[model samples]
Target chain A: MMDPLLHVKNLKKYFPLRKGFLEKEKTYVRAVDDVSFSIRRGNSFGLVGESGSGKTTVARAILRLIEPTEGEVRFEGMDICRSSESEINEMRREMQIIFQDPHSSLNPRKTVFKIVSEPLIIHEGLRGKKLRRRVEELLETVGLKSEHMFRYPHELSGGQKQRVGIARALSLNPKLLILDEPTSALDVSVQAQMLNFLESLQRELDLTYLFISHNLAVIRYTCDTVGVMYLGKIIEMGEAEKVFSMPRHPYTKALVSAVPIPQAEQPETAILLEGDIPSATHIPSGCRFHTRCFEKIGAVCEEREPETYCFPDGSQVNCHLFKSTALDDEAGHGGGSGKPLETKDR
Target chain B: MKPVLEITDLKIEFDTFEGTSHVLDGIHLSLGKKDTLGLVGETGCGKSITAKAILRLLPVPPARLVSGEILFGGEDLLKKSDEEMKEIRGRQIAMVFQDPMTFLNPVFSIEEQLVDVISAHSNRNGSRKEIDRKEAKKKAVALLGEVKIPQPDVRIKSYPHEFSGGMRQRVLIAMALSRSPQVLIADEPTTALDVTIQAQILKLLHELVERHGNSVLLISHDLGVVAKVCRRIAVMYAGSIVENCSTEALFNEPFHPYTQGLLNSILTFSKRKDAAQGIQGGIPDLIHPPSGCRFHPRCSRAMKICEIEKPSPVEAEKNHVVSCHLYPVRKVKSF
Candidate 1:
């Protein structure tokens, strides 16, 4: 198969902590460590993780919003990560981002017209009547009218403000859109509207999306391929349906099972992780999920990080249960009580 | 079975500079003794306002009670004096807000706050038990332990910021349970926590309610969260209760269009193939709300009568009720 629209290879981002007055050594917050994924043309690739899991960091790193420590972000065959200044500036035209909170992300003082047209003016140098027409057209595409272009950001409702944000993101007619918790701040009904609009927009524009959200249902609905992150690592990645329906990793199963169904009763069996996610500043040595993973393999998961295990169905999981290799029984990787963990605990 | 709390024809209005915002348009609900009722809705939908009205937490100057009575265990809370309401606030009807940080005093330790609440209720009105700080401390530690807070004895001395978001919410729950109040109103208790921690907190609430036999008014936007803890759910849309029914009936056969819209918006694992759809229009402005049914503008099956006449609650099915013009045959004549 040909390479996907976007290929992110082993991206790493480490934020160095300020050294204390007396201490000589400094610590680093490994925000996004050794993460890799790809989004096919016009397909949304979701990145799901709890807060501090570094999903957002990966998105930012790919866009070069922050200087990534290492790795390559190849966008449409161009290595944006290592590209020259002029090339990156040109690359920015084909890529844009929509933030989670439109209220904060948008300038309160700027009218909807200015907010949406600013991107177009910066990139294409459209002016006056042309710019206004473009802004109105963009607004119309997002289901807003020309009349709304004059209103300030604060005047618009939460949902309407998000529409303006979308219009602005689409001003440049970008091929790839990085949506960071795009619908999280909106209400339930409003979220539905935005999600539908996003779906329609994707189909019409033939855009690729890197949808990042902690909400599993949103990801399940919007994303085609999914990557589940745990402590700055993509522990699982596969087709959205398979990963959600048949999660292999313990953390993935717990996340998948923990999603509340709007039914009367919960499922009988649930893989409830033991504690809160550990702080990212001091990530666990091997398999950061071991601290909370209820199905942890005796001592192997704690000491050695499991290598990526590829299944027959094109799914990848970083878990010991699916550790497909010659293993000596004495090493504890092949514990006698091994259940070959899937969704259920033995 | 008698209701632990009953709210009848409860209407609330907020006087803003633009106009009078009709926040709660005649909310009617009853919590049976030892029952958990979930009041679910989107933001600014009056679910939170209803919760505030129950405790008289809304500021009187800005918020006016247009009409209706809040009856608590056979007595009208609206009629109670300020002094009497004070006694009832913490001891009779305890409340846990959404954010634990804002509700909890950051300056004080958990022990101090928990002990204060315990002692405040124990000594309120006319209780024979003498107020003892030591006993309160002991009870506070026990309450913390009941909520599954680790090292309760040591953790009790820590400040609120020291605990994680989930743990702080558990602390708030512990404080609410500390008084052994007859009614516990948890308003979006787990909204601030992650899905995993939300599960843990939800389990804690269910267990506490079971053990204490306290009626709960669980208000949340997430339908799943409400469904897990509540047996019956009241779906509010634009300051009005559009559907109130058993959790099973609401899930299986939602009568109201708004309720159906909410259910469809959620993409459940089991229903992956079903496409998600939202109500077309935004909520009507409360300042100038629609004449008859607030949801009429967005309803797919809306008729001319829906625009002219407000829908009365109709018995659509067994243990299921809806306020929509679609079910005119089952519409009851009761106010």
Candidate 2:
């Protein structure tokens, strides 16, 4: 499929907890454990999960903003994890990240002009008037006026500040933009404007987006492919429409049902999970979602993790309930161009 | 339906150094008994201020209540003395704040926090001798259990830091409902929580409010959240309620231009043809809002009269009311 823009294979990021005095055993919080996904060119891939589900960690690991413990992050056929420092720095020009909070992401001290111009100056070595013109162009591209360039971060409103952040992210002319909860901080009306602007920008620039948000409705609106993360593991992945409409995995079902729609009439029943997400440090055995899974079946779920089961419509779910589907697909294809039976980990 | 809590001609101005900010401009709201009414608005729309004004919680010099009557249970809450308000605050009109972590004391155990609320109520009522520590502790556990916090007995001893955000919110709910208040004001209660957790909290709130038969004033920026828990919604813009109607009517046939814009701006899961265009321009500066109608500058359907004269509330339907020139009150025709 035109060599996916970004291919992340088994990306794992673990942060080690401080060791106690006279302790021999070392423990680590597996924030992003064995997460693998590929984003096709010009497509938006949404990563959705509750807090501490490692969605942000996966984004950081791919960009090498935070180093991955193990995995191959192939961006345009270049291994980011294995690339040298200089090579990675050069690659940074192609991939940019838009942080969640514009309030904290933008430096309060710097004017909008400086914030937008810094990347251009650092990368292209443009000078004086040229840089000013470029910064103004970027600001205008993000729907802000040239007049806004002189204003500090605090001087601008929430929507304006976010536009500046977007303008900064676009300054490098990056092919891929990892937007982490871009609209969560915005007001509803402003969020709508931003979403529409982003969609138009994507079409105009031919950019690939790795959009991470906890808001299902926003994700559904912005993304093409959706991945549901639970305690550092992607339990389900498929087309956004399919995944949201007919969610297979129990976690996905619960999550889809959990989203409160704007309509007055609610669904008859929602599968309410019992407790909060388990700690990343102490992930539950077998299926990571077993602790709170509503549709869990017997000992298999508690004993062993399910293999990735592929459907005819290109959706993949990791749950034992779909075990027979994978077997049938393998049987029909005779192990030739079949979708499901790739288990290198086993 | 007789309104248990009524706010009429409410006008509040914040006298800041940067000129007088007319925060709340002639707001009118009514909460009937056992009503679950939502106050939905964008940030700086004075939703919180209105709630604060009801409790006389706004600091006076900076925030001057220019004119208003907050009638709670046939009495003017605005005119109530501090002591009288204190008696009514927790026992009658309870509040659940947005951020539970900050509202809850970190050092105290959940049990201690819950017991303190109970004891405070008793001490204020001049019945301090009736309820002891043991009785309060038992009631605290029961309250925690009622909010669906797992293992209330054991969890009650744990500190605020030990509980998750959802659990902490549950504790706050328990504290708010401890004395069984007549009215509960939840100001963006689930805004800080995750979607799943928010669902749980909303469901709990819906169930509890239904069970207790307490009138609730749910203030939130999210229409979806308001839709889930509230039967009636009051859409606030700038410093005024532009529209107030039944949840169904507001969603299906919104009368006000700003209300229509706000609804159109939200991205719903259900597929639709047109993209949300959103409202143009930011919220108006309250200090020098607009010439007349506060929303006129941004309203697409703004008429010339909208700039010259402030529109008064017009009954669009039996219960639905909107403050807009589009739906001007029709003159009664003589037979």
All predictions: root-mean-square deviation over Cα?
A: 4.3, 2.6
lDDT by residue for model 2 over B60-165, one digit each (tens)? 8899978989999899999999989999998999999999999999999999989999987986776556688899999999999999988889999999999999
Clashing pairs in 2: none
Give the alpha-carbon lDDT of every model: 0.86, 0.89
lDDT of 2 by residue, A1-346 (tens): 2678888888899999878878888789999988878888899999999999999999988889899999889999999999999999999999999999999999999999889999898899999999998988898899999889899999888899999999999998999999999998999989988998999999999999999999888898999888899889888888899899899999889988888777778676977878998889988888888888878888899989776777656677888887876568765522222232221111
lDDT of 1 by residue, B118-226 (tens): 8877877475677799998999999999999988999999999888899999999998887788999999999999899998999889999999999999999999999
Worst 10 residues of 2 chain B by lDDT: B326-335
Task: Give the best candidate by DockQ.
Answer: 2
What's model 2's interface RMSD, roughly to a tenth of an angstrom? 1.5
Task: Provide the fnat value for model 2, as a fraction from 0 to 1.
Answer: 0.69
Pick by TM-score: which candidate is best? 2
Q: Which ranges of candidate 2 are over 4 A from the true structure?
A: A329-346, B330-335
Q: Model 1 misses residue B266 by how many Å?
A: 2.0
lDDT per residue as tens, model 1, A10-114: 789999997878887889999998887777788889999998899999988888989999988899899988898899889888888999999999998899988
- Candidate 1, which segments miss by more than 4 Å at Cα? A325-346, B272-274, B329-335
